[model samples]
Target: MKKRTHTRLASIVGLFIIASIGLYFILSNLEDNIVFFYPPSDIEKITNAKTKIRVGGLVKENSVVILSANKIRFTITDYKNTLIIEYTGILPALFREKQGIVAEGTFVNGVFEAKNLLAKHDENYMPPEVVKTLVK
Candidate 1:
């Protein structure tokens, strides 16, 4: 009976250790993959400019500038604050001034270098994150 009790306890402890290690690895990978969403007002607060993140807000009116055939510069605003965004790719059809958009990219030299841009599909549709920023 004593030997059986020891074996059971050891088995439980071993399983717990394995589970802990697995959980740790899963969480670590998730942290690396997670992309945080920010508004134009909060972009300045982020210290890690190299880290990829998403910014959601309205495209500032009259801020779009065509730098080249594929390059464009625009500003995103959360009403009270704005951030310049640079993108070198085709924009979505719905992307236009004053439209709600979510831009995925990294900030460099105070500008958001967008790798991807997402625009609402319908007139009434807006990204939830942008809606939250606008509402605030």
Candidate 2:
């Protein structure tokens, strides 16, 4: 009976260790991949450049500047604050001043370097996340 109980406890501990390791790996990967969204007003609170994040707001009026055939710079505003974004790609057809937009990338040296840009699909469609945080 003593030998049997020792074996059962060992088995339970072994299983617990394996499960703990698996849970750790899953949470770690999710931490690296999870991107949090922020509005322009709250962007300054983030200082980590290595972590990817999303910024959503309306394009500021007369802020879009075409730097080259593919590179463009613009400012996004949340009615409280503004942040500049630099993207090197063709913007969507619906991309225009005062339109809702979201950019995913990292903020570096006071500018948001965009890896992806999402424009509103239509005149009436806006991201639910944007609407929740936007003043209007």
Candidate 3:
């Protein structure tokens, strides 16, 4: 009986060790894919300018400038603060001035270099992060 109990305890311990290692690997992989969301008001507080993030806000009116055929510059505002985004891609069909949008990229030289731009699907749609900033 004593031998049997020792074997059972050893097996349980081994299983727990394996489970912990598996969980560690899963979390480590997920960490790389997690993109944080921020509002224009919080841009000044971001310490790591190289880290990729998503900025959600409304496009400032008359702030869109077509710098080139594929490059564009625009300002995003959360009513309290504003951020300039530079993108080199096709804008979504729904993207327009005074509309809700989320741009994903890294901050460089005081500007957000967006690789992807997402616009609200409809007039009533607003990114939740942008809405949270507006509500405050």
Top candidate when judged by TM-score against the true structure = 1
User: How many clashes in each candidate?
Assistant: 0, 0, 0
Q: Cα RMSD for candidate 2?
A: 7.5
Worst 10 residues of 2 by lDDT: 29-38
**Which residue segments of model 3 deviate by more than 4 Å?**
28-36, 122-136
Per-residue C-alpha lDDT of model 2 across residues 8-74, encoded as one tens digit per residue: 9999999999999999999998973465568898776776777788889999999999999999999
Clashes of 2: 0
Q: On a 0 to 1 TM-score scale, where does candidate 1 land against the true structure?
A: 0.72
lDDT per residue for candidate 3 within 33-85, as digits (tens), equals 56456889988777788988889899999999999999999999999999999
Candidate with better lDDT, 1 vs 3? 3
Candidate 3: worst-modelled 10 consecutive residues by lDDT: 30-39
The alpha-carbon deviation from the true structure for residue 76 of candidate 1, after best TM-score superposition, in angstroms, is 1.0
lDDT of each: 0.88, 0.87, 0.90
Number of clashes found in candidate 1: 0
| Residue 87 lDDT (model 1) | 96
Q: What local lDDT does model 3 show for residue 6?
A: 95
